[model samples]
Target: MKSEYKANSITLAGAIAMGTGVMIGAGIFALTGQIAQLAGPLFPLSFIAGALVTAFSAYTYVKMSNAYPSAGGIAMILQKAYGPTTIAAAAALLMALSMVINESLVARTFATYLLEGMGLKRTGWAVPALGVGLIVFSYFINAAGNRSVGLFSIVMAILKVGGIALFGAAALWAGGVSFEAATDGQSTQIGGFVASVALSILAFKGFTTITNSGAEVTDPNRNVGRAIIASIGICVIVYLLVAFAVGSSLTLEEIIAAKDYALAEAAGPTLGRTGFYLTVLLAIVATSSGLIASIFAVSRMLAMLTDMKLIPHSHFGMKGAIRDHTLIYTVVIAGFLTVFFDLSRIASLGAFFYLVMDIIIHWGVFRHLRHEIGAAGAVLVTAITLDIVVLSAFAVLKWQSDPLIVVISLVLMAAVFAFERFYLRHLRDGDAHHDSHAKT
Candidate 1:
């Protein structure tokens, strides 16, 4: 039997840093300009709205994690509340699909920065090579243990946060206090603003990684919950301030024209060439850290599913050479996907899986606490409603613009369910055969 793991080492600060580090990454640096183009000055407001939705969802997760301070977090809670088979299908599909998409997106962004830094043109091979290399490195670091990865994340988060703060200060020094100028001539359409909020929400997606690794955190109930709130709060403030600085520094037309990695380009005007390089370096570190964190969280989910017998136990333990082999395989798969897919496609796919999982998590919480009233019930109901609204809106938009992607996502999810059913049946049948032979 595998030895049971303990979770008394991770501190509250470490837990909060996990979420903060994961949430405040390449998305803020890259996606901010894109979202600003969509919602103009209201981009900051959209981010705030997204944070609100995430907070509600985080509340449910905190409650669930508190109830069950085990290693699996939400996956384990679902398995206990619903059962193994349901969780196996849902958790596997959600974690695998989301992590792959996230890895691809982060890799593509990292490659762009690397090419810019080296004065080399972006090529077909650049992203794949960089993506594969980073993933492999991250796998080894994680396989070493969680503490090393956690410490590395803390240092990277500090650099990213400090870099953004310095940028904001530079903007202020350059007379960037004109709020009216930032919002001038921007779209005020309510529907468009809501749609933009959905895009902005992607920037805040990493906070849930804390809840996902609840089993690893020390005093999960208290620490994880506190961490979730602190991480989201910090990201929201930093994002708003940075967005304000960027908006004040550049015009709408300039922002739209500076599409890919606009933040770094904008920073050059205020912070000069050296500051621009620093921003690019921060982008690389932020994306790399986020990708590494995703791998850690998703691998835990996979291990949990295997341990619960939802999948083959063979997939769980790190045995002999197979341990390193699995890491290499994962890196290769993620790299291949990144080298092939576009950023929008990757983001949309990631959002689809995460949104569905969020809905399921909310449902599980509500169902488990059906008898509860007042604040807990209110939180559950609000989270479910918000998730449905946001997810439905995103689905509608995607369907009208890109129906094929939406269809493919649903089909892939269904296939995962079928695979789980088939595998479990095979395992049961093999066990029965061994038992009958022993009796004979």
Candidate 2:
């Protein structure tokens, strides 16, 4: 019914811009140093490796969207694969929460760079305050409507990419640093490299945001897949270049030391105060736009879930528009996360949840929905295998370094499933009565 209700308003370029905006947000600017610390001189390679894994992960989305295009998107796919049962509800919520986690991650990144550029201290409440303020601002923008979000995404995407390109080029030009410095003279650990690849996978995870916009994109069938492929391709090139520039400019130790503000720091050597200000300006724009786009997608996702009767709804003294309630809920949770966690912890939690959710998606497609979607069994199997391998490696690494985050991720996942089961049980008789009335 939602597919029939709303007209296609997003152009192909708009869709691609939305995806790129989300991917390029906090990822390269924040995670480059983190990845560098883990992968050492091979940090750039981790992004390329992540892109390869993303290609496999994306195959499931392309096949499903081509077969069944809807704004419901992944939620619809999950229902088709596992029925409108607990698995569908829980897995969909996992994705929604993962996006929420990313919002807080981007917000914190915005605050960190903003403070650093101003030559201010990053300690105490400064970071969280700015982060929460941005979340509130994005909520208001999302409440304005889709057209505003789309236009802003397009503008911000262009500006952010150009700014990043300039930073990379100018830094490389000014420093004249060699590739050997960035890619050599370090002890490389296989496990750490694999784990870092998992983090790099998070950097490009924004491509899936396009699938969530299927019902809104013009020519959903063709454009959804096209936008996704184009987004990933463009991001791969951009991420590789930025990683090289950062690595070339700063040693691994320097990068890790200023991991939270690496991009702005990278500017100090090349363009001095002016470039730092410019890079900071772009980061703020990118993170703000990323928050707006993510809020738009996740709010729509939860609304779709409610429409399908997969989740409960609450008017909460507001109008009956599900998007309104979901929008409020998204900002509140993201603000809470931004207040409590640092960037690395938030990212690790998000990556853990997302990889697990992605594994479920691949499993659903491979084991049950592959034939219906006309997907190759081999490709589906390969996708699932890769996700599992990466997820396991990342989990081991997290367990060693930050076992608390791993525990939090597991407990949160369990809570989602448990809550869904209880809610479904509570509504079983009512659902049966509604079903009987409809049939009659």
Candidate 3:
């Protein structure tokens, strides 16, 4: 039973690989055009803004992990702050679900880019079918355990990061560093720009992948924090390079028009067919590795939640470990999203869920755990303030642009809390009934 919960120790490099694997997968490959749509000509700058905000948000997780690292990264933080209650459970569930959403987002991006190579676009049932296939492939790779995931992540991270940076440099050189997006006269409002930050934050949120696997890292206390900072720093550099590459290679309209496969589009005109195909290959590696790392971390988080009794769990009559069952659950739900929602809707839902959970985390630490964790109140408060602002902007934009998703997000979140509250109360009543009978 204990062996089922056991995780192989990951070195600092492996941890960083895992973090960047998840970050780069969805961030750069699929999100560049989407960011451009909202941020307009200065879309490259949005990654920087997102990184700055993410740095503040990372402070809370770093402090918490340094003080008390555990397997259930975000879950531990929520429970420590709020106790065994509905708020903690519901918030933890939100984080877990958001990670699952990300898996689908990147998987769909994989499908989108792959279709580009085939001279096909993401307009039909084939997109989600391919996305679901990738998710299944990742599940097998992960079933081999942490060593497989870590080594695969390190190798894939090296390939994609180096490949992406190379593409960026080459595009800048060939395109003569044009700033066409700005001069083209297309612009965005402040709200639009702010809303784009939400997507950008999603790009960098892979750092939580590190915090979630703290128990698996060697030197969990120090290396966990180090990996988080290093991963973020590395992503900021890579994301900026790619953003500028895309901006220089294409106009704002060109970017948003090809939003689903912008990197491939940019590569084709600037780098020629070979470079274009190479970029497609890199997208495959990035999104697939990202999906692998994401599924690995998210399943672990769900298993942790079940162990803590924060969420209900049943083996459903087939499982080697709690994690084994959770892994299936993670992929099934992710595959469903891939099948139903398009990339844009998937990204939007993930952003909303993540920002809401992030606020809950910051607030929990500020109200209760700061003193025990030795975190600065100002930093925690800043994270909360920033999240609120971004989430508000995103909500308004979604309400205006795609109101259906906004309503769906609100309903889902409310329903999760309601479910959690009822489950906890039922457990209490069951225990009380047992107690009275025993006394009688």
lDDT for each of the candidates? 0.72, 0.86, 0.89
Per-residue error (Å), model 2, residue 392: 0.9
TM-score between candidate 2 and the true structure: 0.95
Q: Write the per-residue lDDT of candidate 3 for residues 1-440, one digit (tens) a residue.
A: 23444454778988888787778777788899999999889998889989989999999999999888877789999999999999999999999999999999998999999999889755778899999999999999888887798677789888877888898888888887876777788766789899999999999998998898788788888999999999999989989888888888888999989998899999987899998999898898888888888898888888889988899988889848888999999999999999999889999999999999999999999999899989999999999999999999999999999999999999999999999999999888998999999999
Tens digits of lDDT, candidate 2, 1-440 = 35433648888998888888889989988898888887887688999999999999999999898778777878988888889789888999999899999999999999998898888999889999999999999999988877788778889899887788778888888877675435556777888888898889999999888888787788998889999999999899888878877877777778888898888887787778898898898888888888888888888888888888888888879874777898899899999999999998998989988888898888998889888878999888888888888888889988999999999999999999999998888789788999999999
- Candidate 1 vs 3: which has more TM-score: 3
Better of 2 and 3 by lDDT: 3
**What TM-scores do the predictions have?**
0.89, 0.95, 0.96
Residues 1-440 of candidate 1: C-alpha lDDT, one tens digit per residue? 12334567667887777777877876786677667665666666878888888888777777777766666666665665566664545655576567667777777788777777777876777766776777777788877876776678888878777777777777667745775426567665565566566667778878767776677688786788788889889888888877777777677777766645767776777777887788788788888887787776666555656666675544354554333444454566677777777666677777778777777767765776444422377888898888788778777777877788789888877777777788877877899999999999
Instruction: Judge candidate 1 at residue 221 and give its lDDT.
Output: 66
Weakest 10 consecutive residues of candidate 1 by summed lDDT: 320-329
Report the Cα lDDT for residue 37, model 2.
80
Ranking by lDDT: 3, 2, 1
Which numbered prediction scores highest in TM-score against the true structure? 3
Better of 2 and 3 by TM-score: 3
